[model samples]
Target: MIDPFGGIKGKELTNTSGFFVDKEEAIKEVNVSIGILENKNIKKPTFLETLRSKKSKNTEIHNNVWDYVPNTNNEYVNIHIFWSKKVVRSKNGVPIRALKVALVGLKAFYRQINTLKPDLQHPDILECYKLSLENYQNLPPIESFISSEKQDLLLDPFAGVTGVDIYKKYNDLKKDKDLTLEEVKYSINFIDQLELPKSKRDKKFITKKPKFVTFTFPTSESYLNVHLWWAGQIIQTRKNIEIGRTRLALASISKFIENIDVETPDLEIEEIKEMYEITKVKHEPGKLKTSRIELKPISKGGLSYWSTKTHRWITGKYDAKNKIFNPPKQNL
Candidate 1:
């Protein structure tokens, strides 16, 4: 049998595993396919060509691509190709080969009658749209551009950050004063509005929900230990430290998996606040909203109070000798 892709006998690139599509051949095939489609009886959509050169002249199908044709009533099928490539050593430790390309994704577009002009006409929406269009207009032309790194950054869902918590930190370090949070919000909204469909068979294309964990407060030594474990994981995630609802949950879960001993009694507010200060992470709304933890109890118990001055928890204490609080409890 003859090999379609020529074999390599030299050293391979690092960090690449498996095979990658031959970039030169892939580009040639793409161009040929476009020519064939354009010459069809009914001109095929040029959208595929748009995807080909969007990132670079030699497209490697790093992510995914889809060909959409609306109002076809299933007569026309949308094409989707998710081709991933990696560099890998051969059995002889020579060179890499392209992984078998799989065509798993399919999509079909349908047009819908609109009664939503009113919502789009909002002044704020219009203004954001205007600003976004202006930004795109000001960008350098493709021929004059140095690299596609900036374009790739804009296309990232979380801007390459692990999550919202990390994204916030990443944004703060940006020196570009024109890149406001509002503009970022508007840009995301714009992308979401261009909602694309996916093939049922393409399991990899699906967006899974972010994982979450629960933790009750005034917790046991084990529970406190879990929180501390989470703290450590969050610390190791990056050089900068920032806490958020989701980040804290992930940390606790990591600690639980290791079965680490819980040395702390409880994860008091003061301890968390002190951590924020040490890490220089700003404590704002939703910054440390730990989930699965009760803030106040309905039954008999002293109220949990937070001290603004000390930034610590002042737990409700019972006076066993007096059989009551020193000042006595107030009746509702």
Candidate 2:
């Protein structure tokens, strides 16, 4: 359990320091400190008993002022205390008790971090300085770095162009000494509309569809004729084949259809073979003549090889030893 503001009783604190005139002033000061904490994303204590009652012995956060665990770091506390105290000092009717209460809040704020890494000097007693308000004011708006129109085309609805992408443009615009923030904001709005599409599926945003009908016949005269003849036979016989001429022929035809765009391009080899009930050995070889083909094994010192001596794969005895599979080349 931690007490952000340690046991600084109002009566004891007033007896030692001239900061607060009375307990009322101390309450006012604590309230203002609570507001500052809330603005910095710290949650204020919500329970009614926290303001009037002491913390339970079993509780972790000893005070009832903060609802959630404070995530603030040292820099924020230093900046907050410096700015708040300066403002507090410039006003009249603020009791010395107010300052004492602020110190209590500061002590609690310091404890938020100090407990994690113990420090000898307390943040409240340390020589604190004021922060620059003008630095934050001069910083550019977040929307200035983000592109609105570019987000429309991206699949992610929240995607935006980074501010760094617009640094040169922003700097160039700033060169005009008379350029006003209002005008800059307007120009940024114009940039947001650039190249943005009205609709997701608009023709203006879509790419041109490709034409699929045009294709030149295969280069090899023998291969082209074989493919055409095989396709004709499959259309006629409609037989399925697992190996040899029928299977090879159908695979070649399917590939050709895929290469050139056609109206009925999806005719798969299996579908065509099923239509004719084509068996692997059922097909007669066409007029095309082919010499015996041999394949070298992929691995060095391996005995496995493939031969196309009879227009079908004739695997060597070493085929059992070779685990790699090499499909037969379609040279037809």
Candidate 3:
């Protein structure tokens, strides 16, 4: 059993010196402590009794308060100390004993760490302290930072155009800046009439119900007959692609209904409207395509490279008229 209260006899310490726990020598001190108690002249002491008997108040702590043990380096274990009274200055009002008891606990914990590395000179035991008054990091309107201590507070946010600028820009200002009683009642009616106007698209689509329809992919056509025949199909309102003939023959117009380049030689706005009939979402309202599931082992040739910062798969799409994505010529 280690005595947290290490070797110190109050009578033995000079004004400038107190006993320090020796990691390698702790066993010797432990034996000595046992010897002291068994002596007929000395009392058989409990841990606290030994601490009270050993404490010398004027003892100072200097050094190793922040050391962490590392595998390669020599590690130092700590020393534990116990004390009964705290030393005070010449004109002391409050006894320093209360502070001394706390420091004793702190040093005792450090003694354990100091034992591991005998070469360590300074033990990792920071001096313990208590501030006499609250140190305010931000200047509060209150006179003092002390809690439960009576304070006269006059609080207001700082001011200028920074103050009045808020009033002209926001209806919220009526509540924050000290508005007059009459102004407060009047602002309720004034702000009630203010409205954020509904935008053009909001008015257009907000109430309109979406139309959904499914489409079968068109059959492939022999070289020349494709576009000529496709135009005839939409216009004819009917076509027999197997025979490559239509009841009506109109040019095969491109049917694109997604975002436009705005720079692309786009079809007229009226034509864009007609495409809605074909591209209207199927299965789910506003959903253009049904879900697809894909999972593939990615590789440069045939092996995984875990070094990449990001890993994902890429997919492609097409644009017929510009031949832009029939085979994308450049990265998009």
- lDDT of each candidate versus the true structure: 0.26, 0.28, 0.23
On a 0 to 100 scale, what is the lDDT of residue 5 in model 2? 72
Q: Which of the two, 2 or 3, has more TM-score? A: 2
lDDT of 2: 0.28
Q: How high a TM-score does candidate 3 get?
A: 0.12
Instruction: Give one digit per residue, the lDDT tens place, for model 2 in 9-49.
Output: 55443221222222223344455555554444334354764
Instruction: After superposing candidate 1 on the true structure, give the runs of residues whose Cα lies further than 4 Å from its correct spot.
Output: 1-13, 17-29, 40-79, 84-152, 156-332
List the candidate numbers ranked by TM-score, top first.
1, 2, 3
Write one digit per residue (lDDT tens) for candidate 3, span 175-253.
Answer: 2112222222222222211122335234322343211101123343211122211111131123333211110011111
Positional deviation of residue 254's Cα in model 1 after best superposition, in angstroms = 24
TM values, all candidates: 0.18, 0.14, 0.12
Q: Give lDDT tens digits, candidate 1, residues 83-187.
A: 122111001111111011111101100011011221122222222223333434542222231121212222211112221121122221121111322232332
Clashes of each: 2, 16, 22
Which candidate do you rate higher for lDDT, 2 or 3? 2
Error of 1 at 326 (Å): 74
lDDT of 1 at 297: 26
